[model samples]
Every structure is written in structure tokens, then in C-alpha cells.
Target: MTHPTLLHRARVLAQRFGIDITRHPSDRTGDHLVRLLDRFEIDTVLDAGAHTGGYGTLLRGSGFTGRIVSFEPLTAARAQLHRAAEEDPYWTVLPYALGDTSGTIELNVAGNAGASSSALPMLPRHRAAAPGSAYTGRQKAEVRRLDELWEEITAPGERVFLKLDVQGYEGHVLRGAGDYLDEVVGLQTETSFVPLYEGGPLFDEALGHAQRELGMSVMSMVPGFTDPDSGQMLQCDLVLFKQSDAREAALV
Candidate 1:
């Protein structure tokens, strides 16, 4: 929670960008996100970690009127996410996980549900950072490459913005997209500085692939999680834009 005086100042700052942070101070951050999407003319979003529609809800509340296609693998979470978007004509929810390959995979369901669920095993550092993020159990879920469902997730002439919040499985999601990456104009992925999930790619590996191999350039990065005691950075959400050169060449 932000201090009252600090939060009020944040709201005042956000108003400069024509944003109202009274609803959610975090929504103030959406000003930058909205600007980036608008810059790319993005009108569609591929939400990899739908997780009860929290991200989509935030985006819509922040004044984005784009079509949102959300992916959630957990049965319980998908049910809630579906209910949340049931009345929204532009929002759609899918019950599946995206990975490097298509098949069934075991997802570790976190005790707290949405925030910590992942295909990879949780590490000690994760528990140390967030004690409530312990795995409760595992469930087998359908996994597919984003490319395989590209047509279903997107519509014609809709520039896509991809958001990957898949605990530590963002690398697998990116690998699965492969050539489909060309269709995305921008992306926001959560990367970790410390190992939170076993066998998951850290910030360098994930950022390297997106920049060097996928032709995305870093636009912004916001710290996500930090150790309360040591104040050590644990995770961050990285915003990236597809290189103009790749965009033009791909368009050709």
C-alpha cells in the first residue's frame, strides 16, 4: 500500500497524462503502457496469464478498448476469468496454457492460486520472497504453442500486444511463439533477477532472446517484487517494442 500523501501525489502526477489513479494507483502505470500500445497502433492483446482476468480488467479500466484474448490453464481460475469477461464482447478467455511445445503438461498450482501457479517447480527463493506462494499441488493441463492458436486468438488487421506473466515460464511461451512473434507489435513479460522457479530462464536469458533473436528493444522496466528485508530486486515487468526494421521487413 502506498502512503496517503505519496498516493495523492501520484494521482496528481498521473493527471498530467490524463489518467485517473483514484481507482488503482497501479493503473497510473497503465498510462505508459497505453502510450506504448497506441504508438504501435495495437488493438489486440494476447494475455498469456489471464489469472482471473485481473490484467485484462486493469487494461480495460485504464481506457484501452482493444480486443483481449486471455489464456488461463487452471480450471478454477479460468472459470472466474470467464465469468469476469462474460459480458464484455471484446474480451475472450481460453482454457489452456502456452508452452514451447504442444501437449499436456503438469502445472504446479500455488496455494494462493493465480499469482504463483507455474509449469516449472517453485524454488526456495520464491518462498522466501513470498511465503504465500507455496505450491499446493499439481494439475495436468492442455498446453499448446501460441502459433498453433494464432488465428483463433487474433483477428485480421489487429496489431497485437503480447503480455506474458507466466510465473517463470515466459521463456517457454516466447519459444513457442517462434515466427508468430513477427505479428506482435509490443510485449510485456515478467522477468526475474533471482531464481524463483527451478529450470526457468532468468532476466538475462529471457531479455537476450527477445532482443537478439526476436528483434525487440527495451522500452521500459518496472520493478515487480523485492525482498522486504534486504530490498534486493527479485522481479520486474519488462516492456519491449518490436524493432521498426523488423516490423517494416515483416510487413513487406
Candidate 2:
């Protein structure tokens, strides 16, 4: 008996099921980021929880010519991040996690890599949806306060943009960024509508924290993760800018 290859089997199955797996949300979300970049006149970016430097690649490919300081907590991802940005003078990757305070934190490394790895644990719902995202192990990552690194990461007069894809730890990162929120013009963050990770904030709480407490307003939102079976949105990425008279003027 001969076994069919995975690609061949998928093609046959797709024809039978009328499925299209080629859809990508980045085509839309990437456009949104570019518009926000231009609208805010952003020249610098703070990329938190950058995995394998994917976001950096997206920014460069989308024609963004600015300085990007990316922070990754995992060892393997940081190694990949270094290689990905080696040729780009404006892109730099650091081997540390950002949190509410400066210290060491244990990261639950996921076997799937795209799964949640945070101070909190994964709940049953997330585990069931993506069983391969099981915790393979744990690693102690050196954490840094974004405020302490702000001076070193940016030029003297640069207006900053912030992107947070820190799984379930977005709130912790935002808490740490309070001291320098005024310097930032825009923010993009991932929020989950459901309880994906144990102790993780829901979508409303996370968005409210940024809007009400951090002085940011949601400008646009795009679908992030989705359930292929039910066609339900699991997560989304929000584009936000600081709420101030200056921001209103810039948009006008």
C-alpha cells in the first residue's frame, strides 16, 4: 500500500470539503499598521514578546523605515530574532522579557511555540483547542522594566510606537510602561475574548486598562486567532493611539 503525501491528501480533502486554507488576516492587519504608522508619524517601535522576528519582517516588508527594539523571552526565539535582524541596521532584538517590574520570571515554554507562555498557566479551553500547545518545559527569563530601557532603545527626540503580543501577559507589560506612556504615540496589542490562559484578562478588561488607565484609545481592530470549526474569533489585535489634544490634531 502507498501512503499519500500530506500536501496531496490536503488537496484532495479540500476539494471534497470545499475548504480554503490560504486565507491570511495579515494582508488586512498589516495595512492597518502601515496606516497607523503614517498617521502618528511614528519613528520608533517597542516590540514586546517578539517571536522569531515575524513582526519586524512585516514592518520592513510593509515599507516601514524606522528603528525597532524587539524583546523576546525565549532562548530559541531570541537566537532566531538575532539572525532575522542581522542585516537590518534599524532593527535590534534583546534577550529579555518586559514585565510590571524588573526581575526574573518563569516562562512556560509551549511545544507549539505560538501558544501562550506567560507567568500564568493555560486553561482547559486553550489546551483543548490547541493540544499541541502543551507546556514542553519552563525557563527562567530575565525581565526588564521598559522605562529603564527607554533611554537606551530610542533616540533623544523619537516618538515611539508600542506593540504587545505578550500572550496573556499584556497587562503586566502595560503596567510597566506607565512611566513613559506619554512618549508613545500608538499601541497595538493582542486581546482574547475568551479565557485562553488561566488568570489572563478578558478582552474588555485589557482594552479598558489601556484606554481608561493608560490613556490610549482604540482606533481599529482586526481578527487575530480564530476557530476553524465554528468560525468564531478567539483573539484580536487592536490599534490604538494616545488620547490627547495633540493626537486629535494629528488625525485631523
Candidate 3:
């Protein structure tokens, strides 16, 4: 490992170049996520809305050895996702979308390599931020509730973490978790600040649903999806943690 003094100096020098580094990269979200996994002894991760297995790769890169079940709907993306998962025996990719019900839904495939694909309609705000992410086409995809596959993906008494990057369809995904929501030790979902996707819940609504309904507490928030022109943040990833008791206490 590198020396602590050199690391500190590097962080300070990087700041002089107008780069903001938190106490630990200014509280990086992924760091907190891995910390949760280690602290809670997480064994299985449900990678919801996993585009091309990028999230699964991140988890492995971050030292998570647990099982990863990724969900991807688009054909082209799933093709890449399958190729990526070929190396990791523990990482499994499923070609489907997680929603409130199990059925077929039209998924909007974005031009930007399905990076902005979603079951919900994208609004002007989202399109303006990344023109390349504009809707390219649509395809019918099978939707399944997380609870429906809980037994197949995980075992009882195993700590499970659910990460959602389903664009604006997070609400339905959470609902589909069913009773598994209470058992989820850690949760991460992309919450939009502005109207990125039409008819989707905003930041406060999503946060409220996690805390009030799902009995989870906000552990960290990582900024994402900023407008290039205005430089305003449009969305962020909310990382939450839940304890076995009330599931209502701050992590600190």
C-alpha cells in the first residue's frame, strides 16, 4: 500500500487544481457502499437495472466477493452484460426488468448505448443533459418482481443488498421488492432532483419512500447526472442502510 503521508499530499495537491476531495474523496458513495457490505457481512447483491454489468464490475473492483445477480432488459446491452459476466462465476446476469408486476413493458432503448434506457418516458431535461442518450428505439421486455426471484438468488439469513439504477422506475422496483424490503441490509437507488423522467417521483418523494415506507435511513448521497450547460446537478444516488430492529437509525 502507498504511504499515508504521500496519499494525503496527493489529495491536497489535487485540491489546488480546483478538484474537491472529501475526507475520503469527499465521502465517495462506492466507498460507503463497500463499507456497508463489510460491516453487515453482505452475501448477495441484487443488481437491479443493471445495464451492461458495469455495476457488477464495480462491486468486484471494490473487493466485494459476494454473489451478484444482475438484471438487464435490452437485447444489445444484455449481450454485452453476458460477455462481461462470463469471467465471474458468482456474477449472474438475467435478461429482464424489475417492476411492480411481472409482465411485458415497452422499454425505451437510448442511443447512448442503452445508458439512459428506462421503462418510463424521458423528459426534456434528461435529453438536454445528454443528447446522445435520446431515445433510439423501444422493445418489449419481461418484468419480474424481486421477491419473485428472491429464493433463487439468495438464501435465508444471508445479508442482501439491493442497488437500483432503473432510471425513473425506482418506485415500482421498490414496491416489487415486497417483504424482502425489510430484509434488505443496504439499498442504493438513483433519485432525480429535477424532472428527468416523466411521471416519476422526485428526490424527496423517493427519499420519503425509502425512509418512511421501506424503513431505511439515508447513509450517503453521491451527485450524478449534472447539466452540462447550467452545471446544475440533476440526480444523485441515495445509499441507505437498515438495521434489524427499527431500521430507522442513522449509520453514524
Candidate 4:
């Protein structure tokens, strides 16, 4: 599809799903990401990999008054996030990175500011070299497991919506967030069938793990362009919801 036509379709899909995608950048408010949170019934949102706070800003603008915790690991991006949060009282910006384990780890910074970051250990293979690569490099950053972070932030019986866009670290983030899985009503993650990040699991394997271990099932795919059951391969966003919560969401 042509760029304009594709964008028009995306806008229609976003409106159908009750998301304000027109104002945000395409990379930030794709159809899959919006649909994933469409059924969430909570105010508290966790915007993991919240690059420039686009999602958080959009949620609040759409009347989500609950707390939004935005996490970004990159120094420059975190600075932007902090500035964005300053304009909104409900949004909280954190500089720590999240993964399956807690410690300091090397983050591969890519040339493209948007897709240029990952915490995977095996980096040399996935690093893209170009003019963008000039801005790309590796840096040590503090990391924590989502489960641990959830324990510190969540209250009793509070519903949480999580959006994960950490290049290829989705599986690791989910793996470390076992405690928060049951509490999470919705999840929006970028999934890759190809090895975009070194040592990252394939999309199917990651989705299976989310379904079996995290108590979430596939709710939608990004761009609204793929069949949930189609055995095709592509890199896209994967929306997930707790099985029980999904049923309730459907009933609503």
C-alpha cells in the first residue's frame, strides 16, 4: 500500500479502537499497540521503553487519569521522556532498563533513534552499521526485572496495562515479570520473527511463552494486517491479554 493510503487505514483502525493515533508518530501508535490496550479497564499504565513518552501522552490525552510509569534506558531518550513527563503530572519517568534479570548490562544503541536500542548480550551480529551507526554503540546501564519493579509500584488489586517496545528484549522482560503477569490486564509488545536482536527468541516461541507462562493470549497484531492464526512470518506488534480478562473485555 502507498504511504498515504496505509496511514489512512491506520487512522480508521485507531478510531475504531478508541485510540487517538493521528497525532502520534506511526512507530508509536500502530494499530496493534492501540488494540491491545483497548479493553483494559484500569488507570495505571506501565509504558516500558517509553522512548519519548508518546504513548503515555496519548493515553492521558485520551482521558486516562491514572498513573503512568514511563521507563527508558537511553540517556538522551530518558532526557526527552523526563521533559515530556514534566508537562504532565500523572506521568512518571524512570531511567532504569528492564530485563529477565537485574544487573548492569550493555545496551546496543543503533543509529536510528527509534529502533536503535537493545539489551541483548550477543550484539555484534545484530548491530546495523550506517550513518545511524554513528549514533549507535554500546553502553552499560542499570537493569531490573519487571516483576521486581511491579512489586515496588503496584498496590493491592490495582489493574495494570503494560506496553513493551524494547527492540528485541520482549521475552526477557516478560520472563522476569512473572509476578506482574497475573495482575497485568493488557500487554503491547513488538515481536520479531526474524532475529533483530542477538539471541532473541523467534516470535512464535515468545508468544507461546507469554500465553503459557504469563497467562496472556494473543489479542491482536500491529498494523491490523495479519491473521492471528495465520502461519506467516513477519515482524510486528503483539497484543496480549489475560485469558479471563480477555473474556471479560469481550463481554464488555
Candidate 5:
């Protein structure tokens, strides 16, 4: 972040040239996410796979002041996540992974800042494409079912938005969400196009389960993990809203 005076001057200079530096045609994921939450009157955000509070920080930076409960299992990352939310009274960080059941699981720690760390085994394609994302070690992590924590984390009638970034564990998290999925108004999950993780569900299966079983319709698909050489998108973030929501309502 630049100094306030310098930022102001830069904005002023850009405005004189008939341009808005802050507004662009490229990906503005944060804006779209916050807009959806606001439109649906979301009171709380359940960040199912928060890694060092990145998504939670994105929400706060995107002007979402609602309560955020971020769940992370990695010890180091969880510590960092706690520090990130320490200043915000409404932001909370938990040291548990959301999965199909409550227990412990072995996580494949990635070599690169634990960004690629996942409960599932990393596949050769992922390691070959990004060496830094390869597994370096293993760690045991506590797991929790989202359904069991739903009522504890939220109040009745409070609209909720659940965000999942669990590498290949989207299905597990949703299954754990169970009947509480009906209570959620919207969600965003990272869907894999290939087998980046062993036993991972591919894009079509993930999409079908979300739409058919979860009762959601696609809102948007944003390119996420891409192969540097082949230029193929291995994963994408799929944002969906409940089919019961007012799709005909004006977004403007």
C-alpha cells in the first residue's frame, strides 16, 4: 500500500488522462464476490479452506464488514491467520479442517509456502507443472464437519455464504455440510479440471453435484490454477448461488 498522499496524487493524475486506474477490464474477483454476498444479504461468511486468511482479507478489503469465520488446519498458517484477524473483532480463525467427518487427517505440506498443501495426496501432474507446489512433508490436522458447527457459528435466519478452497476436498466439505447446505444462500468452490490430487473429482462431477444435489446454479467461473507450459487451466473458481434466490432481480 502506498502512502495516502501519493495514492491520491496518482489517482488525480490518472483521472486527468480520462482513465480510472482502479477500474479495469481484467479480473476483479474480489468485487464480484462481495457484490454477490451483499446482494444476497449475507450476514456471515464461512471460509472453509482459509490459508493464512487470504480470502478473509480479500472480503474485508472488498468492503465486507460481516462476520467471518475462517477454518484452517495447518499449524503455521493457522498462527498467521490468527494474527491477521486479531485486529478485527468480527473475524475469527479456527484450527480445524472442514471435511466429511470430524477426525484427524494427514496433510501433504507443500514446499512453496504451504499454498498447495492439501489433505489429499498430490499428483505427479501438479508436481511436474509447479515444482514449488510439491509435497515437502506431512502433518496431522484436526477435522470437523461443517454441519456440526453451523448452528454454533450462526444464528437462525442469518444468511450465510460458504467459500471452499480445499484443493480436491470440495465434495467432502459439502457432504459434511449436509442439510445445512440448504441454509446457505451461496458458495464459491475451486473446481479441478484434471486430477491434480489423487481421488479428486474433476470439473464436471463437482459442478453436477453442486447443481443437482446442492440446488445451486452457476454464477461465474474464474480461471485459477493454470499450467505454465501448456497454458491449460487446471482449476477454476466456480461461484454459485442458490436456485431459490431471485435471479430475475436487478443486479444494477
Candidate 6:
């Protein structure tokens, strides 16, 4: 279902600022997305919240030889991730989640896919309509700070690209990365202006965090089909770049 309110608002804003939102594709991870990744010359990818290894499969299919470290907390999903990596030595699957601090927590599983799961306790009004009610079962999974994982998985002098789609946990995940932000060249995060999930931040707030704390600049925002340009805000996929890396990339 398309969100007319969101589309209307986005279109109005685009008209006012002379921004071209028409060219932004609904599926951000298409050829255009791959082209953007190529521009950064990204070798290694940190696939935070990699659901069923679809993104990893896409990257490998596109000739990305660099290592992919995927993190998924759900038990069933992790099995699928393992299967996807069975033949690919470069892919390492981690059956865990990333947070500001490392410890075990309750992972609320929704019947749907990655978008439905959350680390938070309660479901938001918007997500209440999501297929399958929240599961009460709990799992003991290792939660690590991003900095620690980066040190463990990445080699020195390797430029890193992070793709964070951890439902509502993006802020906490970014916070955990701390000083390791310097090692990253590019990032793609799922943002929500409205509370699509239980604990997600608003679009402006998430963008501000990326700028002030993460030391990154917004490169682009791709709206989902439900989020049109004009009305009720939904979710967006945001691309970001470290200021220094962005400048260097521009010169290339």
C-alpha cells in the first residue's frame, strides 16, 4: 500500500527546493545502488542485520570479492545465512546482534522478515499491523560492540563499508562503533521519520546523529513504496560518507 501523505509531502518539498525525487528508485539496492558502492571502491562489507543473506548474495554476484561479515540474531534466519555462505569462503556469518554495550537481550521476533524483528520490548502502533504477532520466546546470543567486532574482523588499512538495517537499533549500533567510525568510508542505514517500528528515531533526528556523532554527511535518501514524497513519513534508506572520505572520493 502506498502512503499518499508521505509522497505528497516529499513531492511538495522537492518542488519547493527544486529537488529531483523522481529519479530515486523504490528499491535502493538496485543497479543505482551498486553504482554508488562501486564509486566508493568498497572492498569489505559489514552487513549488520543481514536477514537471509540476500544483500550478501547480491554483492558477491556483482563481483565483490571482499569479505562480508554478516550479523543476524534470529535463530531461523541465521540458518539461512549459513546456507548462503556454505559455498562462499569470503562470507562469515555471526549469529548475534550489535548494540552500544555487549550483553544478551530479548529479541522480539515478528512472523515477517528482518523488518519485523526488533530488540525492543514493545511494538509501535505502526508495526502492530505487521504480519504475525510478536513471539515471546528468547534466545541467548552474543551481543558485541561494533568497535570490538571491527577490530576482530577487519584488517588494518582496509576501508570498510557498513550497511545497517537493524530495524530500530541503528542509533545504538552506531553509538557502539565509537572511534571505529574513522575506519569506515561509507554507510547505508534504514531511517524512519515516523515510528514505523517500536523504537526507531525520526528521520531528522537520525540524520542529525549521523552528522554530529558519526561524522558523516547524508548522501541520499531513498523512500520506500509506502512512503511517498508528500504525506505521512515512513522509512528511508540513507547513504552517508565520512567528510574526509567524501572529499577524497570527489577528487578521484
Model 3 residue pairs with clashes? 22-25, 22-26
* Poorest 10 consecutive residues by lDDT, candidate 5: 16-25
Summarize candidate 2's per-residue lDDT along 1-252 as a digit string, tens digits: 989777656644442232234446466667768877977888898999898998898888787898999999898888889999999998988988998899899999876663356667887766655565667899999998888888889888788999998878887887787668777788888989999877778889878877887688888987665554455677888888887738567667
Q: Sorted on TM-score, highest at the top, how do the candidates line up?
A: 2, 5, 1, 3, 6, 4
Clashing pairs in 4: 110-116, 111-132
Q: Per model, state how many residue pairs clash.
A: 0, 0, 2, 2, 0, 18
Worst 10 residues of 6 by lDDT: 125-134
Q: lDDT score, residue 136, model 5?
A: 84
Better of 1 and 4 by lDDT: 1
Highest lDDT among the candidates is held by which one?
5
Misplaced by over 4 Å in model 4 are 1-38, 121-135, 224-234, 246-252
- As for lDDT, the candidate ahead, 1 or 3, is 1
Write model 6 residue lDDT over 23-141, tens digit each, in one string.
Answer: 43434455555666667777789999998897788777665777899999888888899999989988999977999999887777654543456786534444333323344465566
Candidate number that wins on TM-score, 1 or 6: 1
Instruction: Supply the TM-score for candidate 2.
Output: 0.88
lDDT, candidate 3, residue 222?
Answer: 79
lDDT of 1: 0.82
- The better-scoring model by TM-score among 3 and 4 is 3
Query: How well is each residue in 1-252 modelled by candidate 5, as lDDT tens digits?
Result: 856676556644543332234443233778888887887788999998788888898888889989999999998888889989999999988889999999899998887678788999989888766766777899999999999998889999888889998989888998898898888888898988889998888999988987987779898887666665565768888998887665325443
Return model 2's CA RMSD, one decimal.
Answer: 4.9
Candidate 6 is scored at a TM of 0.79
Candidate closer to the true structure by TM-score (higher is better), 2 or 5: 2
Ranking by lDDT: 5, 1, 3, 2, 6, 4
* Alpha-carbon lDDT, every model: 0.82, 0.79, 0.81, 0.68, 0.83, 0.73
Residue 161's C-alpha lDDT in candidate 3?
Answer: 86
Can you give the lDDT of residue 9 in candidate 5?
64
